[model samples]
Target: MEFDYIIIGAGSAGCVLANRLSADPHISVCLLEAGPEDTSPLIHTPVGVAAILPTRHVNWAFNTTEQRGLNNKLGYQPRGKTLGGSSSINGMIYIRGHRTDYDDWKALGNTEWGYEEVLPYFRKSESYYGGTNQYHGTEGELFVSRLQLHGVTKDFIEAGISAGHSHNADFNGEEQEGVGAYDVTIHKGKRWSTASAFLKPIREQRSNLKVITGALAERIILDGKKAVGVSIRQKGKSRQLKARKEVLLSAGAFGSPHLLMLSGIGPAEELAPQGIAVLHELPGVGQHLQDHPDVVISYRSPDTSLLGVSVSGSAKIGATLWQYLRHKTGSYASNCAEGGAFLKTDPNLDRPDIQLHSVIALLDDHNRKLHWGHGFSCHICVLRPKSVGSVGLTSSDPAVAPKIDPNLLGQEEDLQTLLKGYRMALEIIKQAPMAKYQLQDIYSADALTDEQLSEVIRARADSIYHPVGTCKMGRDENAVVDSHLKVHGIDNLRVVDASVMPTLVGGNTNAGTIMIAERAAEWIMQDQATA
Candidate 1:
């Protein structure tokens, strides 16, 4: 098969890219996804995230290398392996990070990525249900709305305010510091993934677009210095698809870097040891890994209103499910993590360095561990960590999982920040509104000393599902992609995904990832126009 563009990984970015690039009738675009189509009913239900997160069903349940920082525990990395990618299986919270995140990118020589310049792209991908404003859009494909506030979620917000934090209705608004309900990517009663937002509406109408699922991209087919096609394996058969214009990698942070290395375009030493010939010597193919190291503080709540596996909880869910099926409202339509906050560890910091998620469930170890009764949990993560890690080849085979080492909490500063955030979470729980719901403390106490609390943090803290910077975009020596998202020393190849983020954003990365694709699609179109 041949096309003008071949986009690998039909994830958050690829969906948007396919929609925008295929808009012109003159060009053809083929999108390759390693996973199956998003046909599962669980994918569209807002509460189905609980069932999807801990299993391998439509999820690339990858595991990180044992980190010495976490006492040699292998952390779990769950990525979406279906059409919409992580957006189909994520928490569905809509966050754009801090404005300074983009400004910092501009400072790093990416002049087009500054806050003022990228805001339009951010607005372009969102159809804010709250109506359009200076910072939001009302006509975009992706739906952003406020979920019906749960009683516990409202109480959590009240507790935050009582704890001296300000109440923010929109974290993506004038400021990102405050405790409030989050804006989620939900429409009506369903989880509005990129597939539903961007691809679904245009899939049947666009004859030039071809979406191939269950296609594992083995490597990019390079003709000398230029990328011309992709070799893929599907249904026990190997085939090659040609790209007449460009090959865009939107396989996300881990998959993009892994594919680049598998295609002999990464560090020489790493590929050579894996028996892969190096076609290009890009030392930064998978360096500078960053993620939000999160620690959850949970409590056993007698409030049957919260989600759990107990009898009453199950009964409540059954009723809510019926309500959702009928009216598209109720607790079943919740994202679970209905409320959150962004705050600074140090009061004098210019922006929030820590983020909080108030989950209406007893979430332990990414829901890998379950409890009997109803409860509430709060997740605290350092927005930016000083520690950096890398992604490397485990083998030359594309099917083999990459060696992911986030090196979370490898730096003392990260641990300190998490410790402070943990303390802040405890303080909020102590407020009357939240304290009333606490039946028993399931994690730690406020009286724990700094040393004791640090140990607790080190033992429990892991990723909050935000990972970026493996294939960072910049003009620095380690940059894999330039400001236009084109590979530094490659032709007709660009990576449009979270992997190109020069730095980790201050919040959830879904909104930012979609914005990146919107901006890249415009540039790609502009280049095509000139060509």
Candidate 2:
């Protein structure tokens, strides 16, 4: 089979690309996904993320190499494997990140990626429930709305305000500092994944677009330095699909770099060891990895309104389930991490360097650890960690998982920043609004010194699930893609996903990734007109 464009992953970015590129009836596009269709009941239910996240139901469930920073413990990375990708399984918090995040990208030589140039693309992909404004779009495919607040979530926000942080109604608005409820991607009580927002509505209508699930991509078929097609194994059968014009890789940060190395388009030294011949020696294929290293400060609260395991809690959930089935309201309609804040660790910093997530349940070790009763937890993370890591091949075969090493807290500054953030989180929880519930600290003691807190950070901190910049875009030798998202030193190939980010954004990456695809699709269409 041949197509004008072959998209390697039917993820958040790929779905948007499929929708926009195929909108032109004359253009034929093919999207390949390693996972199954987004059909699970858990995927559609907003609160079902609790069940889906801790297990491999629809997740990649990739584990990182033992991190020396975290006392040599392996970190869990649960990426969504369905059509919508991570967006299908994520917390659903909609954040475009601090504006300066994009400004920093432009300063790093990606001239067209400044915040002002990219804001329109962000607006173009959103249908804000708050109606159209300078910061939001009202007529886009994806829906964005405020989370249905629980009493505890309201208290968390109040506590933040009482703790000296101003209340920010919109984190994606004029400024990204202070505490508030997050705008989520949930709509009509369902998880509004990219597949739901972009692909499903148009799938039956577009005959020019072909979407294939359960297809594992093996390698890019290269004609010298140009990518011509992809070799994939689907249903135990080998097949080769050619691309008439371009092959776009939206396989995400890990998959994109891993596939490039398997296809011999990465660092020669790394490929030679894996028994793969070098096709293109791009040393930065899997370098500059970044993730938000987080620590959860949990407390056992007397508040039974929060989600947890107990007779009353279970009964509440049962009732909530019934309510959801009937009217799509109540706790079942909530995304677990409902309220959040972006704050500065140091008052001197230009922007907030730390982010907070207030969960309505005791979330320990990504919810893999079970607590007996009701509780509340606050997740604090260094928004822009100075530490960097890499993603490398564990085996030459595509069936093997990549050796992920986020190297969380590998830098001293990150650890110091986290320590301060930890104190801040504790102070907020102890504020009058939250203290009225009489929550007991379950993770740490008040007597623990800064040094003790640093040790705790080193032991408990792990990724908040945002990993990016492995295939960064820049003009430097380390760059894998150019400003137009086309792979450098290679023709007819482009990487349009989070992997192309030159630096990690300051907040949730889903919104930023969709914006990238919106921009990329427009550029591709413009190029097609000239071609």
Candidate 3:
């Protein structure tokens, strides 16, 4: 098969790419996804994310190298494999990150990425609930809604406010410092994933676009230095497809850089050792990995405020499910980690260095372990860790997952910041709104000394599932892509995803990923027009 544009990975950014590129009407586009079609009912409901995310079918379910910081435990790294990518199975927080996150990119010589310049793309991709304004868009493809806060979720916000944290109604608005309900990529009680927001409406109408699911992209088919197409395998059959113009990779952070390495476009030193022939030697293909390092303070709530396996809590679950079915209302509509805060650990800091997620359950070990009864947990992650991580080949085979080492707390300061964040969270929960909900502190609060907290931080610090920077975009020698997102030394090729973020955003990365795709699509069209 042949097309004007071939997008590998029909994920968060890929879905947006498919929509915008095919809108020209004359150009043809092919979007390939590794997972099966997102037809599962679990992909629609907001609560269904909890059911689908832990599974391997709809998720990549990658695990990092045993972290020295986390008592040598492998961290859970779940990347969405289906049409909407991670956006399909994520917490669906619609945070664009702090304005300074983009400015930091510009500070690194990515001049086109300042907050003011990229704000338009963010607005262009969103159909915000409050309608069009300076920071949000009403006539856009993606739907962004403020989740209807449940009792405990609201209380979490109130508790943060009582703890002297500012009450921010809109995190995406004038300022990002505060506690409030998160705006999620959900609408009308359904999970409005990127595929739902961008692809669903145009799939039938766009005759020039083709979407192929269960198609695993193995490598880029390059002619000398130019990416000509993609080599894919589906149904035990390998097929080669041509790209008339561009072979855009929207394959998330790990997939994009891994593909480049597989295509013989990475550092020859790493490629030769992996038994893969080197076609192009780019030292920075799979370097500079970064992700949020988080630790959870799990507490048992005596009241039935948090979800758990208590007699009353279990009964409420049935009633909530029934309510969800009848009117799409109730606690079932929550993203689980309903609302939280973003605050700076130091007063002199220009922006927040730590973020909190007040989950209405005991979110221990990324929900890998189930505890006894009703409880609420506060998750605090160092927003900007000095620790650096990396992604590399575990095997030459595409079927094998990449080696992810998010070196969480590899730096001592990262641990110090998280400890500070944990203390702040405890302060909030100890206050009025949340104090009433607590029966007793799950871990004896008074018994938790600084040493005990340090032990816990090392034992529990894991990712919040926001891994980025494997294929970094910048003007440096180690950069994989340029400011325009074009692969540094390759033609007809570009990576449009979170991989391009030179640094991790100050908050959830889904919204930033969408903004990146929005800009990429527009740049692609602009370049095409000039051509």
Cα RMSDs, all models: 0.9, 0.9, 1.3
**Candidate 2's C-alpha lDDT?**
0.93
Candidate 1 overall Cα lDDT vs. reference?
0.93
Q: What is the C-alpha lDDT of each candidate?
A: 0.93, 0.93, 0.88
Q: How many clashing residue pairs appear in each of the predictions shown?
A: 0, 0, 0
Worst 10 residues of 1 by lDDT: 438-447
**For residues 1-531, what per-residue lDDT tens digits would candidate 2 score against the true structure?**
999999999999999999999999999999999999999999999999999989999899999999988999999899989899999999999999999999999999999999999999989999999988899998899999997798888988998999999999999999999999999999999999999999999999999999999999999999999999999999988899999999999999999999999999998878999999998899999998999999998778667787888877777878888999999988889998999899998899999999999998888888899889888889999999999999999898898999999999888899999999999998888888887667887758754888878887788889989999999999998899999999999999999999999998999999999999999999999999999
Q: What is the TM-score of each candidate against the true structure?
A: 0.99, 0.99, 0.98
Error of 2 at 272 (Å): 0.6
Off by over 4 Å in 2: none
User: What's the true lDDT of residue 413 in model 3?
Assistant: 94
Model 3 TM-score relative to the real fold: 0.98
Ten contiguous residues minimizing lDDT sum, candidate 3: 438-447
